[model samples]
Target: MSDEDGAGAGEQLSDDQKQEIAVWFLSNAPAGEIHYVAKDVRALLRDEAVYEAAAAEAYPEYNKAHLVSLELPDRSGDIIITTYGELDKNNYLDPRTAQVATVDHVKQTCTKLRPAADEELPSAYIEEFRNAIDMELSKYVGEAYPKGVCAVYCTSGKDIEEPGADFGLAVVISAARRSPQNFCNGSWRSVWTLEFSYAFQLVEIKGKIQVDAHYFEEGNVQLDTDIDRKDSTLLQTPEDTAVSVTNIIRHQETEYFSSLEESYLNLSDATFKDLRRKLPVTRTLFPWHNTVAFTLTRDLANELGIGK
Candidate 1:
């Protein structure tokens, strides 16, 4: 790649393709994720330089310092949201509720790596690193994976390590499917390969906790039949769907979050019994974590007259 401002270094790539390349580079580059990140940052700064030059020529009032440079906080983290699934207009499930199952996850955390000195700007560095990535993407402007990046700028970090306090400087990812025709090509065909970026934050925790439960329209018999039939129509169900779901909850309760059982002890016998009566399927409630997840059978839901 030529070093002439690094604006036009390589062949223009689609936004998705660029992200794929970036992921591969971060995971497998010879120097590793950190090294590749630094290199990308330098390249992005070069692109910024090129932009400034062009803008300066066109508008005499253009200021280089005022350019859209990255402003990062001392303790900052990066979040990446990846979502899949076509917009099924026929389905009536709440998008937000369904999205709870497929929310994006934080692929990396840079908080611990930040410089300890008070004068250092670790967040700024991280933001610059992220900006460099955005700069590397092609200059496309349409919805089909159009190139763009956004960051939350902060000035401070969480210093106290209080118990039960979530990471002060952290990144979280959330994702949801959109309409099938959300990103149609010139031929009006939905482009499944396309992706987009979104970000948000939650400020407070109320008295209530959100729960996630997947309701199967088909009863256990139908679920088993579908699994056995291996019908392509049941795209969401695998042959081991029942087994996998059961094992997942079992594993989380028995091995991963064993402390949850202690938290369960605090609930009154009536509440506990009522919970089991309502959700008799493979389920687990982690009171300490404020999470209750369930995998329900259609028959049980019907018995409760849930969707009648």
Candidate 2:
């Protein structure tokens, strides 16, 4: 097909054709040339149909795919070549094919499903709880870290079952921070990372809430020093300096983590209602009857085609 016609019609090329285009582009395209690739290698540099077909063959999982150059956040003149896939209705990539879960994925997977009256908490609830924990721990973007490298994640689950409790909630909260310091005449760069993981099950007993909590925390410090010994001070070698600095920072970070854990524990035990009130986006609570009524009204409107 003519390039213009193919472009206008949005033609779906066959796999073999796409493969041919991809092979041709790879043979002619130079490495690390992001501008050429970003400007639609298929349409700008070669036949549109040929270029698109090749992309499809290479990235079969994406319905529509294209090459893009993404610059590193460090502004180090480094660029990564990756495919930008077509977004779904929710403006998110499909989680089944994506390596990382988006915020929408967390919301959908972690939000507790309403349970049937008097039924045991669903097995799915445990999976959701586990997923939420994993999601929170895995995040590496937040204000606390350099350039938003680490994130704080929190998720909640309701209707947890416990003896002598009317209702229960499962809460997971995690945070991480990295602080970097330059010392010894700018010869050494030290990065200190502190991480906190806290999980709690809050159950209401005798009209008062109680919490059972567990936590795991750690702090890491690493030093990147100049390879040359010229910058070393006469009093202490780089190795000795590193050891002393690491020890002091590690001790301080441990105390910091302990303090944070104690504060959160107190909040969970003494001010749980206040904590719970801050979690959800909306404070307004709707009755089950109101939801049922809204659903029925929507169904009736659809049947009558009133909006249409």
Candidate 3:
């Protein structure tokens, strides 16, 4: 049941009395948040359950303001690519447009179901898949060097401990490029080499997967010319070896609510009527993308039927 219709503190404050106080308080006072301290207020006006409902009705603008205050930011990323995964509905944004404004509500659930038994591939097929990747990458490496280097790694959400669900695949493609440098008054040509790294990520959602590919320029790295070639081996030094690195794509995880009890307050009709007679009417306009707060004084609280 809503807090408004719920039972109040004991037989001292009946539902009718609380409702009457809430209605009166709302009508009398200017539209704003009203706070009453139990110790400072009278017994009749001490309960706030009735006040909150009345305030919501009398001051809809205030409630809307409170709701908007909980909004969170949208998710963004690099070039996205998906193969088996889809992004039609299940994505970073929630399906319900109305609840989008709610802070606790998420846009999409990144839960992936297990593939059907028939859809599963054999171990040999999986190994072949890995080999196929190596073959495709080898085609891009310069013919001068056959030892083309590439790295593949996996990353997952904080909650994922094993290779179960919500896993991402990252591939770093490092290719060699050669350019000639003029030295000794343009008489000598120095061959300088660069290692271009291209990175991409595959993230699985409910029915489909989402892929984000990094820009070529952002992942490129220039390496030392290292061109003392003996046979097919381009030697820089014994200590110099190409290293493969994986770029991790970061995203916000879903936030869960905790089960805990807490006390909150609002204003009632009778209290509002009393407030109208006692407190001065204050007015303020709300903005589109901001939060506003105010403090009601003791004298105002007392006059509004808050206490003696």
Candidate 4:
């Protein structure tokens, strides 16, 4: 009933509208047949003709009294019907609006860093760095990727000895997007997933901080039935008798990944430079250095077995 249900988008349907659709389906859709087997009567009669005559006489009454339900078939047609039926029932939202909102939500709330519990580095300094990185990444949200969802997670080492050297930090970023594209008279949903793992190192030279980073990126995309399928036979191959959703997903995964690889490459390059620039920088020790000196001193004392 809420926006969070069913793909996290789409308008809520009124009770009247929902009831109307249900009634239409029950009245017009295919209804399963109900057959009554009079086994005991047939055994007692011991006459095929008598049993048949009795069955024929009682058939109309039984049919009128029993309930017949509409059930979807257990094949590809069911999939296509259910998918589009739900969308129409809920008054599905526009794909473009859903895509943009999803990306914005990810940008605002998905960047996170979790340092080890035993880390000896000053928490304040670590938090400052994380905030800085998150801020830098925010600028690329709607720019580098016009539509998609992205999340970033960073983990740091337990012991960081140097202020501006490699500290065993690792960052992983995950991104995805959904698109509904028209095919013939119907539509298909294309979903993409991209993951990037970065080996991160920091360097400071002449009061300026820089990032020395290398990352490995991989991506996958899949397509699923979204709307009407006029000719189900079109989805099947000459050698096959039925449509295989698994094969369709796998084949699209490979094809779309290759086609979209260039866009992801551009995003990666732009992000690397953004990290290097460390934009909105202040003179020496970043903008959060006002109290970092004291915190660093305390950390050093604790490391030397002199302070708690």
Candidate 5:
């Protein structure tokens, strides 16, 4: 038998095939980085009833899945948002036993350890989960297995001097990491091999869309963490999605202030509530980490010129 087969596979793979897979991982799901997070999130929004169990792992701050799943299937996957408290402070890599090895060698190793045929979770699982929820979101969306699952955790140690530049989910993740002294170290437990997929409506991306945000003034933006911190269960806590949203928007505004200075449209309080009701769903304008600065797609950006 060759050296390529995983737990259940055929003969060993060629060096070229191994390298191709490794390149694919770097391009698509580079470990610890967050790209296209819409996939793994639908189940959380689709099945709020499972909030209690998942919260302990998925969302420690809040529970009660809502509409966050809609935007999910759009951009989702298992993102290395952050690692556990046991951070690898030492930049030193473990001693290498062997000399230089081709990228294919590493790929072959990964293939044997874990099967490469990764696909989004099936709708059947989502349905299995939905059936378990108490609130029975059947009215809103009581279908079956979710398309995927995405977990985002922030690594504890890193050079965060730059506004938003890190190995994982970029700024969104680094910012999400709570202070180490705050207990739980701001990181959450999550499933490792999960990913998600979604197709959201009201999808608006103005190439020139930029927004600079101001604090709500009333301090409503200040997160109320007492409740979440006290709870040992994740589902019981309030998902940090609300605060997470506002923070992202603020960060974007601050980082890309020049570009997004006046590019945003404010939502009314009621509208904000409408958005909040969707919790974690991509439909909600989440107020992503810092600022809200996403330029329109080249295709959409041209529209402004037409009107101008």
Candidate 6:
């Protein structure tokens, strides 16, 4: 429900009141509430029951959020990936927070189904998903992370603990608050969960160690099959090392240069802005690029009397 739903708490809804509320909702939303009329209404009568069933009441009461049941696919057989909103139709901002965002309020039950059994399935596959939860996960509240609540969500990996319907889910919520918009623009920003800018292993099962990751952002997740390390002898000689460390070094260099260029630009811009405040400017060259040894462009060299 929205923060401004205006449902005053008169010390919890009673059995009669709950029934009346359901009747009211059903009467008001007959077209949409038709499916849930058979199920869920009894459970949702009391707020506590609703929270206990949905696992979404973890936020502070001020947020005024409600529990939402998201039905992800069982992945029975065919190659089709089952997608559902972690909470598609929230009463708040863009409740459908995913790549695919559409809702038909006509029914609450699943609209479609697929088969995943007959086709040979891998032992497991990496599923990339995301969301933002809270910092502290308490027993009284629902499942949140160890930081403040994050607005973004990414569910990157599912380990598939069992073969049947009893699969385990490793959910990651992007709980970082007060961040630059770039941080959530599908780019990596350091987060406490990712261990603060340490080297990481993206280990996808595409069959080789082809890695391309920029900044390991807060909510990014990996299936960690450790597929690359699985067949390694750990102490093999260079002759047997199909994976060379040089390739890794090259990747790091590429990422480093990109960041260096960004930093240089920022420094340059800041330096010039500050200098204009203090003295006359013959050029707009910011001095920030001077903090580290400047790497001048060929054209800039001749202008600055370097390589003259």
Report lDDT (CA) for all predictions: 0.24, 0.27, 0.24, 0.26, 0.22, 0.26
- Listed per model in order, the count of residue pairs whose N, CA or C atoms clash below 3 Å is 3, 4, 32, 0, 71, 23
* Candidate 2 Cα deviation (angstroms), residue 216: 42
By summed lDDT, the worst window of 10 consecutive residues in model 2 runs over 181-190
Indicate the TM-score of model 3.
0.17
Candidate 4: regions farther than 4 A off: 1-122, 158-165, 180-308
lDDT of 6 by residue, 1-308 (tens): 44377555545555555555655444322111223442465455546554333222222111121111223233221111112123333222211222232222222223443232311121322121111111121110122222212222122223433322221112122211222242211111111111101122221211121111212246532111111211111212222211322233223323543554454457445644565433356645435545332332221222212112
What TM-score against the true fold does each predicted structure earn? 0.16, 0.22, 0.17, 0.22, 0.17, 0.19
| Alpha-carbon runs more than 4 Å astray in model 1 | 1-126, 129-168, 177-211, 214-308
lDDT of 3 at 24: 59
Model 3 C-alpha lDDT per residue in residues 99-200, reported as the tens digit of each score: 122111121122332222322222332223223433443333223123223322222232333332332322332221112121000000111122211121
- lDDT for residue 3 in candidate 2, whole number 0-100: 77
| Candidate 1 lDDT tens digits, 1-308 | 56574546656755444444444433332211223343674365455444333322322111111111111223232222211111121111111112111111121221222222332222443333223322222111122222222222112232322222221111111111122132200100111111111122122111111111122223111111100001111111222322332233223222312232333344444344455433346555535234222212222222222222
lDDT of 2 by residue, 174-249 (tens): 1212112211000111122212112222211111111111111233212111111101111122234333333443
Tell me, by lDDT, which candidate is best: 2
lDDT (0-100) at residue 16 of candidate 1?
45
Better TM-score candidate (1, 3): 3
Q: Candidate 6 regions off by >4 Å?
A: 1-85, 91-170, 177-284, 290-308
Worst 10 residues of 3 by lDDT: 252-261
Model 5 lDDT per residue over 1-308, tens place: 33443523555545444444333433332111212221233232344333223322332111101101111111222112122211122111100110111111111111111111112111222322212221222111112112221222222213232222212111111112222122111111112111111222111111111111112222312211111101111111112322332233333323433332133323233334354444555656555333322322221122211111
Model 4: per-residue Cα lDDT over 16-40, one tens digit each: 4444433333232111111212554
User: What's the CA RMSD for each of the models?
Assistant: 25.6, 26.8, 27.6, 31.2, 24.6, 20.6
By TM-score, the candidates rank as 2, 4, 6, 3, 5, 1
